[model samples]
Target chain A: MIVSQKPIEIVNILTHSNRIKTFYLKLKDRIRVAPGQFMMVWIPDAEEIPISISYFNGSTMGLTIAAVGETTRQIHKLKIHDSLYVRGPYGNGFKIPRGINKIWIIGGGYGIAPLLLLAKKASSMNVKVISFLGARNKDELLFYDQFKLLGEVFASTDDGSEGFHGDVTTLVEKYLSVSKTDLMYACGPEDMIVKLIKLACNHNLNLQASLERLIKCGIGLCGSCCLDPLGLRVCRDGPVFPLKILVKLNELGCYYRSPSGVKVKLSD
Target chain B: MSINVSLGALSLRNPTILASGILGTTASSLIRVYKSGAGAVVSKSISINPNEGYKTPVLIDLGYGYINSMGLPNPGLDEMIVEFKVVKSKKVKLFGSIFASDIDEFKYLASKLTDYVDALELNLSCPTKMGVGLEIGKIPWMVEETTREVYKKSKVPVIVKLPPLVTLIDELTLAAEDGGASAVTLTNTAKAMKIDVFSKKPILQGVYGGLSGKALKPLSLACVFKAYEVLSIPIIGCGGIYSWEDAVEYILAGAKAIQIGSAIVSEGLGIFKKICIGIKKYLEENNIDKINDLVGLAHRR
Candidate 1:
């Protein structure tokens, strides 16, 4: 289908850190979105960035912003009630299994956003939730209370100022070790997912993962979001892929050059 | 309402084409483009044999452009014929773009796919590889000899895709016309690369990639304008055409049609229809009728 730009109104802006903010946008028309889907957010003349929908309630879309570059900083500068251009609900979302009794969800850094939304969705299905979220410090820790209200929440900060003295991945690993679950969902740094994927596979838990690639178009045109080995376009096949497929991604950690022919490792 | 931009005997319902690369990788993608409303779609440049192309991280995104060193990844002529046979949708015309390391490979693949496609695009100016670099295009005799060989054996109309380099472009176009080229598509992305300061390394595996998007529009326009001045054939201008204004620049500069690649990456597939609509609005506002009326209009000054 032709991608149409939709104008969404920002209902609220929750500042998560000095570098990151979360925008709760309510569209003029109802927006249909699934967990793990992303929207191309427009920033007038600067640039358009692909941001995963962190949380959405009815007509509202929540975007957790990390001001990693110029475009996102511009996005951060937006005020509540400001008009923002958006296109999509693009890419395949996390596949919700039927008859699940309990589910485990994990998030790290800004990746915690989408899984938080998924957790809220799972709650309505009557699935018991265990969430482990982590950031570098207490200030960078996001959405702790929102997730805590939904279910049992575990928060970790690297600087030892929070619940745990280590990383979120460690906390999720500990939870997974003790919990009986039907499925596991995770979003975070590649290393975290790699560790979680191995853990999920070892425990024989059903696992789904949301991977972030250098995205140019939210659609499949640019070929920038290709995962290694399978060469699957994240914009088309998925931003959320089953751990079964994600585990086989060979270029997941290989250092490579950007499109400008500059050499940079995929993970720094 | 529809507009037809003539490419020899073939007529495109709109001026927007998928351009080489992008979604032109396979017949299924080409079919998808036709379904998406592109008046025409050029197949990815194919070769006589299978090519694995550059390693992972072959494509990168610049703010207003893209650089890719895909190395003409293709499934060979034999595999491409199977793809050609399945294009049943008559509404969107198919154009097969082919490249080769040498003359024999070009002729062989051209003759093989000619019967299956309406037109053949000779890809002599890919920015990724130096083996098939500007050497052939920089010389008049090389262009004449290669085009002559392919044109002699192929039954379909031939379009010589040119690089953005100004040097010897007229000579190359003249040579292609001499060898019986039906039209020309100008211009391919210029070769470029990026570097990372922390890692101290080149960005692409090949150290160079084809640059496309708004960064190359002015250079591409110059190539089309120059080629149009010398060649009495249809010209398909492509390079950083992100808006209708860019497409109009191509037409007024002397392009009969235009192709879009990198913009689709940032804008999505809807860009084609959007550009066509914008072009229509501009034309209507300017009291222009057929798009042909504006071709070469810029040269008057």
Candidate 2:
């Protein structure tokens, strides 16, 4: 039997924004998961895409995906009980550092998916948590009430359509100014990751952030998800990495690849 | 129960080897695949200098198979020596794959890797530049000349890898044989593409890329079949092999050994041991004492 490929039935789907939806799947086996871990979702003939675990509970889990690309577009059409091939909980996920009682979680856009899981996990462990969730507008902010159940939420919208008028990073910077934390975590567009990396580095705070790259084989064999020069495979070495590894890559915020493998500056 | 197989000077305890371009970049990765139960592992095709490859969506999947245009990304030969040395120390069965846009580059790269690997697998199966005329590794004379040049400096067995985009698989196989190739790996990823109806354009950033996985299985098998008919040297079957059954099929189709790429990504590192266990069981059931007995068994009338 193929252990990696499991046929899971969709129990339900939670629509957040027009583009983002969370799929709750019922699996035969108990899926042990952690924040920042990603899964490779497969539909028989449509396409295969990598998704981060938005939430996990015993034999069931949720995947928060945006219907932006081809594979994700197909996933948005999936109905309940529809069997899709699911594999993993792959890659190195975020780990709570020792002696860290207070934590800050920051994210923007679809990047909010994994951070939501981190917030829930930290609060369940009785750790104090603060989250800064952002999007293009108030309508795009995700996991509003759920995040509130876990910790304080600072909602930011790029268009000033909600709480904060500027970017999420500004909210995070402002929060850190008012109150400091033992550790910080972030995920978002490359530019945001770059900005957060600098913020964490400057403050001398330990940071772990989940990154998204062109993932072909989530198990690390594909050689598609690489940060060149160091040859780090994002799928295996990380979807989540410590601040040190990101700093080592050197190209962190400066350059990233487009879907076609062309190098593009993060500023672009 | 011994699944050891030989193709010229190279020896593998099991017939399953990691194909080029699949987790073959670093020394740690090669060791990881070796520890996972691969009889041997091949490095991704390295060239004269480092390449950034195509773009972000360099690879994509369509359930049964994948289409990727990695554009042969590497840190070039100079930067790989340290990693190669570390890999050599692990003593994992390793074959190094080298590529070039011209004849001189082929000889130079092969010469540099002489001491780092057990053998050299020359990748002449690219789209353009320095093949017979149009297709690379397709023309018989081009194959012979390229193989001979690399074989000159390569101390170990020199194996030529061919793409399925050729007119005559046998002729190219024979050409490698004539040029003193130790073995030939049949078929690299076949060129393919997918279109996004929503975007009204190609799904891949690059309009065309190579197709692998179950989609290229038949093509690889046919190349091995035809190459076996014409050449006496060992032929390593690659492309789309996912399980032990796929491995056995390649052997039956006259492949001396087989390489697996896309399957490992789908099946995980466990695939190596899974394929090995399945082959041992198949051999035990068939009462076959040696793996070579099954190699090219289907060639009999």
Candidate 3:
């Protein structure tokens, strides 16, 4: 267990809704975390939750959180200069996979957090990165300015209140049709990842997904975090995996049996 | 100054080992954790065949703790053998944790892995996703049968990992002893769930999950105390040990050693060294000469 005694100062707070807020963290001790990786933000008495790192410079780390429950809602209470305990840059982050020149990053809701980091890193490397983001309307779409600095960005929403008045996946597909991207990275809803995997397969494009699996101990012990079939742990082996591996195993490549040791279906 | 605990023939440098299921799937990750100062590390649960465990949204943060139903996702025994072999070569006190859909598979997995590592951490506890998870730990007969088979086949010592949910600690502990377990690990993650208020849905693909982290420590400590009352075998205590104070509490509560989990995510690999130093300072200040003196002190009081 690595203890981060240094208190991370809240430099900025970007609110997405009544529930969600993005904390701009200035670390007491600077550490570099890759895109698609996450930080565990400790809110006093509220419990620590893993939020994906949306953006990072040398001294600061950005955490975009949806104020859904106690932890997130409590996190929303933080004012500028308020301090919290944080650790990580944990888990397997999205690798800029080799042999890819141009890449498309598709994100929805809070999923835009990690994708924004990916886009920024790609832009730094001059990887021709393009980001397609969506949310319920305009309010839910986060990191608008940061993502814009990364690449050519496309936006969408469920209601006609935002850029592309349709699903974010529609924007992703539209972009893929217009411009050729060698590789794609996606994170958001499970349905969205599944749908994107299907689209990539149908179109014969390379795809990688940062899956959202139930995890207890992020380091991979609790057995609570096992994925269904591919016999891989989302905590250890992934939060990010290539679509090629996802196509094989059951329940999105987890080996989950019920408490009775009975193999149950994902729906069950 | 930190306490040292034994799993069997192997002597750990410290009592705090990374509990089974924390970053043990790959050789690289295991090595990274070992270097972090855990006396030992347990591999993730591997089954008989290739298993893709669950779908996406497997993890969610709840008010109390985390709810995850990842299931027991892993490549089969054959693939795990390769991974375990690499782990063993690292010369750390590596342990293998395995789960099966049935008794026969558990026996088979134990037989294959027994020769490769210092010990076998049998996972009889897992909540949420399903399959031979919490059921085995919850039932004495199932624990006895599977542990018996594994103990008989293994060259190394066997440790049965139990969930904290068990209502009968004495019965389960005795069952493990009858099956020839060298030791028993108390308190796996607790079953839990998180709901998305916006979507009107369960946060995880599997819906329910196991809760770990600081929220689970008290219940886990109570379980350890209860199991220590009847079972003479060494018990490995786990569930939300983050600091030296937490580790010392487990010792006082009667755990031979403790395992650290969720803290690593929030803290990082540096936690191992920090805890070691903190424990040393505590011992030095308290004038305790040996780690054993701290064990079960609360029970004595």
Best by DockQ: 2
Write model 2 residue lDDT over B1-301, tens digit each, in one string: 7999998878898888899888777676678788889899998788777765554344556777877766676667875676678888978888988888778888998889998889998888754222232255777898899899888988999999998854588888999999999999998888888775534566555567788889999888988988888888998999888899999999988887889898866687789899889988998999998889898888889
**Which portions of model 1 miss their true places by more than 4 Å?**
A1-117, A120-219, A222-233, A240-268, B89-91, B130-134
TM-score of every candidate relative to the true structure: 0.63, 0.69, 0.60
Candidate 3, Cα interface RMSD:
10.2
Q: Order candidates by DockQ, high to low.
A: 2, 1, 3
Docking class of 2: incorrect
User: Can you write out model 1's per-residue Cα lDDT over B33-120, one digit (the tens) per residue?
Assistant: 7777788889878877766566534555566677777777666777667766776444458899988878988888888888888899
| Residue A188 miss distance in model 2 (angstroms) | 7.9
lDDT of 3 at B166: 47
C-alpha RMSD for every candidate: 11.2, 7.7, 11.3
TM-score, chain A only, candidate 3, equals 0.89
Tens digits of per-residue lDDT for model 3, B1-301? 5467665566789887887656566565677678878888888787887666665344554434555566766666877787678777878788788887687888888888888888898888878546544588888998898899999888998989888864687788888988999888877888887654434555566767888888998989888888888887888888888888888888888887788877765576678878877877887898986677777888975
lDDT of 1: 0.78
Worst 10 residues of 2 chain B by lDDT: B126-135
Instruction: Estimate candidate 2's alpha-carbon lDDT, on a 0 to 1 scale.
Output: 0.80
What is chain B's TM-score across the candidates, in the order shown?
A: 0.95, 0.95, 0.95
Q: DockQ for model 1?
A: 0.08
Q: Name the top TM-score candidate.
A: 2
Per-candidate count of clashing residue pairs (backbone under 3 Å): 13, 10, 56
Alpha-carbon lDDT, every model: 0.78, 0.80, 0.75
Could you give the candidate ranking by TM-score, starting with the highest?
2, 1, 3
